[model samples]
Target: MAGDNVDGVSTRESLKSALKEIVDRTASVELSGYRDSAEMSGIPESSSKLAAQETSGISGQSDKELKPSPLSGTEMASTTATSSKSKSKSSTATTQQSITSRVETPSDADVRLSSAISGLQDYFRKPCFVHSRLDDAVDVSSVITAMSPDNFSHLSHSSLVRTATGVRELAKRIGQATIKVNLRSILIVTKARDNSLIRLTRELARWLILTRKVNVYVDAKLRLSKRFDADHLLDPSDHELDSCLRFWTPELTSMMPDLFDLVLTLGGDGTVLYTSWLFQHIVPPILAFSLGSLGFLTNFPFQDYEKTLNRVFDDGINVNLRMRFTCTIYKDGHQTETFEVINEIVIDRGPSPWISMLELYGNGHLLTVVQADGLILSTPTGSTAYSLSAGGSLVHPEIPAISVTPICPHTLSFRPMLLPDSMLLKVCVPRGARNTAWASFDGRHRVELRSNDYVTVTASQYPFPTVTASTMDYIESVSRTLKWNVREQQKPFSEDSDGSTTPVNDDEGADDDQLDDDWDIDDSAFFSSSSSSTALSGFNSAPQSAVTTGSSSPLHRDFLTLDGK
Candidate 1:
């Protein structure tokens, strides 16, 4: 109905264009008779079907061929021209809508990228988990090596500064590496005769057997011998353990340290001390749970055992090196006995009515004659223990130093002394004394020192590498466990003559000033040759090394005055 003669154009394109223009012209003119004829034009099948339904009501010319009509050429040309103008307007509207929609709406990827950019600064603003005060105050110079996570072979420098994701990455790396360390055993040492300890041990043992793939060991007597009250912990036979649990008795004591990778202590600080005693030579990492009364060394909490174990197995633990004392008793020039102590070696008058007289010598140099109730030769780790009770300075364990505190000295001038870790100290019960003195290691291994007997204290080659709990380090542990520096209440400020309120801080101010002056003095002079040097063994006379360890990180060194430098 609409195809006119076309000389050069494609038949499909020309026919469709002419049909579209004829349909528009006829529909607008209400020429209903010709509508059916236009619908039958040689257009595509889809367009022809749509036109047939839209013009169904039109009369005449149904299914007619698309040919030049009988109308005059002038009228046909004018109608086709009008239809082309309207067609162009409709096509332009459709194209504009398509372009506008594409530009206004964004893709999912684009939206996500925008969100990430907006939140990037906030992601970096969040602080990483750390003990700010402890990390700041720590003197890392004394630390021979800080046990942290892995280091890439070529990027060893960046490994020292832990990143935000360092812990997680390290845990993954350590777990992969430690997969081969099968039979990683743990030794549990608890306080004796306490129902709580028995219950804890039983629970821990059960957890170990059911959940972990490691071996558990306890004291043989705790599981074998018939104890007074706690029988439940021992009721389960060795067979029930599936060979995953073992025991260490008196006979096997020498090999306990070598067999285990870690020690779990379920008592107070005393439990830690006892555990340290068991491993006389080389102490394993101890995870000391704080159940005892005084828990200075027992930093871990019983409640956090599961989390602590997870970290331990993944090598996420901080191991602090604790210096130990190697004490040897020399009786009549013969080495009579030898032992190791995690804390101090005490020489006191046991059950004697008179004050004990002890001759102190450092590296074969006569130091002084001490007339006191007792003398405490403590390692830096022990400074917070027996030495602190005897008015000794709180020494940082990593400083590589030893403390000597006189207990109830006869004269007020007798003060505590702090010496380098390399120094060899000798405490002698002079040739003739009023009463025999007593010597003890870490408050255990009691021995009597007769006249002319001597006890030598030196830093042990074996150092105790204690596992630090996630909660605290040495400084925080001391503050929390020993309640050090904790005042009951603060006194109100007093008004000065200048109408300014001043804090009523005690003699701590003067002490701070003296400490600064002491940090400046050459401590090498203390070990120098001198004739009239008085023996000092008290907190006030503690060595400068104890107060301000010289070695530290570059940042801390800026604010800290170490070794008078």
Candidate 2:
């Protein structure tokens, strides 16, 4: 046993010495190769020094025992030289085996190489992929070249150039107008299981204080119980509460007016909606930070808080103006109450009544009498919300349009319709209507509507502000967010390709089974291209059409213009 122990110690020492020599030789070879390559490529010699420094830092305490395995030393050295020769080839394909082997080996060299590869991957993947059309290219020579031109009118340019210049000018104006006015207070409202957001909020508050941008006011529920004193000991709970209140709410007379210029919400879309509803009348522009699960509205990433805030303060990024709808409920033909809706306004039967019978009218013309569970009146901004779920078209935000979608109507012919924004919409329950209906705004704030009540809705004067990084068009946002027809590779049958056309399939002749059965009848009755003679009856005929034209169909024209206000 004594002899065996002595032999093991000697072998270990010999291996250690061999590894030290191999490491020294490898380092010398790598340094020389790196220098030669840098000189050949005309790269600065200082870069080699920096790389060496970084490599040394990564090699750390292993410097003393920096050695290669005895069995693999010769093979590894030969492979390393071959790899250097093939460095101009595809790095990924050539380096895979080496990377896997190194990862398996327990050494600082392996860890350093893995870290460098990861850093390279991160650098290559930093920018997002954007798709643009050929006609959308803008000449940004003045901006890119750092030339201070007074106006874009002086330059000869195309329509794309003109649009880019307009955006630049608008950004400049926003920058000039938006000053970092000292905020009187700030409120960070959140719900349960949000410790991560709570910590991030505290850090953001500290950042704001350090920059002297805004005076923050946190909710009383989140205040720390104790304070640190001169001796590094905590003060009494009463003293801490007093100090916190002094900063949060100074005056005792009334709750401090929401003098905050921005309400930075840190939660899901539900949280944003709640905050908007809480201060709907007095709320300022919101900069929502996404910390919850689904973030359709709260888009600002929590990790990039600093960059986002800087852009808001300095660059004046684009803010998407979202429109809201205001609905007034009238009981017995008099305006009784009003509600604001950011998403949509719904008129439906609640738990107390049976299904509803709603009579919808546009500009005093009876469009349809619906027997359904509910009806949704929404602006283009709200089209993507409940309206989409109820089978309405997804209208662009900039388009001046409104959607009327019925929810589970009894008649299959009742389909969603888009109307011009200028039209006034009314939903009323007739005196002999079956059930009582309730009107709600954004799924909250309900008001009971009796058989003799009506709800009228229209576009409101107020618009919500949403901040974005770029001035991409509305269609671009939809395409990216909704993943609509985004192809990973170009197809040969694309419009730009000059390929032979393929033969049509026999299956293409089949009728579309997805169409509703009642749609054909409805189309023939309401939207026939040819004009036909018809009597003008007011909601009395079973199959009479409501649409009319003048001079050609006298009876239809008279019925359409009967009740002119």
Candidate 3:
């Protein structure tokens, strides 16, 4: 009966029955597509083919020579491992977290290195594309070596090695390493009310990190809450108040001395001054990146963070060692306290209705009784800052001088004077003064000075080091940053030309001749007049009757008359 049924079925019906059976058999196969294996292996089929093509391209290279492409996550990790292995080859490399190989012969190596670096410099001089990757290619060793030792010393060995490696690696990867420097840390400090400046500082920090991968640290307590929530921050929680407390916890507080290499200060000159005051005792170098409206102390531009930072790391820029003032406050003839200032130590009226009385003395000699709103005692470096506003002369940073400027003096006769750096200045508020004065160090940390309180100020033993580009000079920085008489055209006298010297006026020469002639005439007339007077006196004194007799003789009479007159 089964055989008859099979024979009765048409060929198409038989084919359909077989296809249905096949479809039923593949139900498990369709279920397998939904299984974990298919879902878990999420890579597209096209990607495998693309990877295969890439591998095939480098198939001819030896296994050792053919590095895995860093684009792939696994391959990148593998490459990093390989790099770590390469770094471990040297004993000196073990201490260093990053890979750095020292040249066996630095003197000989520098020649070849300098040539390569010079080529890179020429390449960077032109307009070029700027990306994070491009910045890694610039070789700044030549520029570093060419800079002054004082400037170059500011850059650590690690920084120099990293910069050189980044430059060289970039050049090898691409055609050139684009120069994009960054100021890594910017500290913005303002009063509790300065929200606008705080916002600007945050914006600057965001721009730097996004465009240049620079790190920014804000030290202002008022903006700490907002900065902790900033979106661009990688580890917002890391900078939380709790984290900061944890960092300075009992265990780590002792180690705080060794934690930070440098500190960066943002905001105005006041912020920099405040930061310097806080760290002066610790004595770490500061990189002050200005974010304020007026930046006399801050030489760095907010926009050129990348270039500035790169110059710091790569070329070993110079640092101006700014002098600081150390003040010792005395109360009732006892040493009460000591403070340091980067700018000026200002003694002013503290909420008093009347002007403060300040008796100033320089090296034990009484300078003057300064009756004014305040007095500014500043280092040469601070001359352009608060002192300048107080009618002080702008002294160069390199000059060893101190500026004593009176602020809003009651008398017009009071003018600023530059004193020798070696002198110790004593400022006192005498007994029964109309109003008491207050002393502040760098616009921070104020101390009240009652009647009979004395404040003594002198140059500090230590100096603050400030890093700058290799091409940066103190005078040039003042001119460019401060916009102090930056004239484009040179005066004729200033021009470098081989020309005839200006002639002296004939009147001047005649005056000199007349002076000589007058001296000679005076000397001759003096001797002649003395001799004639003696002779006439003797002739007239011979006798009153002799004088009347000499009147008949012209020579004797004239001589007698000249002697009498």
Candidate 4:
């Protein structure tokens, strides 16, 4: 690897030297043209031969053919002087006549001087591609001379008549070209709870701005109050923060995802989830640095941030297109509000004594009706989140599927099911339900769903493109996080000096799937898109079995429950 790097550096140095040589040659030719033209202009008109010879030497072109010479200044001057002195009187007369016919309206010296100036202007205006070999190298003047204006005629079809509009369009293209080299913007989101994470964010931001000239955007509140605040309070520095960096608060963060080229999240999986939620519509790619426990989504570590960012900047990494769901609440007919979900949307019995009843409709067809603690409609990207705890399947983020899992469903037959992303889901609260069901989108946008109110779930048009670390992918993340297929250390068969093996414990590793009992506190609150009742008449129809509430006894259900019998 060291040898390869050395070779690469050597090749780059060679290329740089070759390019510098080409540029120096071009500059010299331009400077030489100015000097020769100035010298020729001062000479008397009688010395037309000297003027012609000097002009030829500077322009690097012969009079007969406009073919530029690659000879050095001294060589060109010697060659021109020798040719001029060696020519016979008859040859000189023929040359002067040939020059006269070419410049019929003007003298040979004036025409040649004008041509030389025009050649310099053309060389300066055009772009040049330098060859690696010095022998095959051609200067700017030669390239422009060999190139025919007619060859680029197609570039300005409307300029055939030289119209005012064409001139304006050409000016616009030139202005665009001048501004086309844009510097990319990067947004940094760090975990505020940890001082180390905040410090890392500041260092990363400073490095990006100072080294890459990239614009960095951070939460203004965090920058003002947290790390920045602590820096001033504790160990003060002589240097101030970069003035070029833009600070944005939570209110302004809504505009950030679109303005920035990429997002760098330094924290745990929750930080990435939060960033994903911030971009409710279009989400730029994210580079997540893991600095917290259980970093399923935060693939890269803070220690490897430099290498990880290098890969991202060089576009040497791939992005996983994680699916998100666009959920809307229809109160009557019109949509109340719409929000996006990177994780599961939980519709649960919030602070209610009775279980929440929900009727699920898939693509206008009744899929199921269940009385449960809640219902979770999760995108494949969210399968490993709360949905997993609710007994939902772990789906790969790349899969175009959605999981519907019921939280403590009363019916034993109600199992989590995966459906195609194209399927539209409508979860409605039936009339005379025990209580209003509350819905939350990715643990936010909590709204109360009364009788006849429904919320629709569909795949969002925009997918979140997340960058992963070299260490883990989706499958590895699941294995690492959930400890999937992990087994306990089993004791091999052993005889206690009796030629008999002790009874093996069949219950060993039985609790491998058991999850931590730590209850997740519901601190976040949000609502999905909601509409009015009149707009929801289309979904009022439900399956007969779904509409009926079975009796308390598992076997003795009332068939005529709709009649309240």
Q: Specify the highest-lDDT model's number.
A: 1
**TM-score, per-candidate, Cα-based:** 0.53, 0.49, 0.46, 0.53
- Give me the runs in candidate 2 sitting further than 4 Å from their true place: 1-187, 191-193, 224-258, 352-354, 363-365, 473-482, 486-565
Q: Compared to the true structure, candidate 3 yields what TM-score?
A: 0.46
| C-alpha RMSD by candidate, in order | 38.1, 28.9, 27.5, 26.5
Off by over 4 Å in 1: 1-183, 224-241, 470-472, 488-565
Ranking by TM-score: 1, 4, 2, 3
Q: Model 2, range 1-565, lDDT digits (tens) per residue?
A: 0111121222222222222322232334332211213343233344334334445553453432333232233444445546565765756665666655644564544434344434323322321111000012434444445434555446566854776788777445542333232232345555445665666766676566456434455443354422211111223443422322212221200111223445677787777776656544324456778777646676778789888886766654455556667688899889988765677899888875577888888888888887899999987867877898899888876556778999888887889998887787888998888778988888798888998799888766545555555555445546645666777663342221234233333354347556443332223334333444342232346333433445556566665676551
Model 2, residue 273: distance off in Å is 1.2
Give the residue spans of candidate 4 off by over 4 A: 1-183, 229-243, 470-472, 488-565
Candidate 4 TM-score, true structure as reference = 0.53
Q: For model 2, what is the alpha-carbon lDDT of residue 314?
A: 62
Worst 10 residues of 1 by lDDT: 124-133
Cα distance off (Å), candidate 2, residue 531: 39
lDDT of 4 by residue, 1-565 (tens): 0011121122222222222322233333232211212222232332333334444443454433221232333433444445665774556666565544444344443345444434333332221111111112234345445345765556565554455565456434422221111225677887766777667777887778766776677665554455555334212342343434665444334422334557888888788888877776666667788787887787777887777676566654455667788889889767899887889889998999999888999999988787999999998878888898999998877667989999999888989999999899999999978899999988877899989999999888666767655424877877887898999786675443535344344574857439553324321111113454543542366445544555644223543553466
| Model with the higher lDDT, candidate 2 or 4 | 4
Colliding pairs, model 2: 19-67
RMSD of 4: 26.5
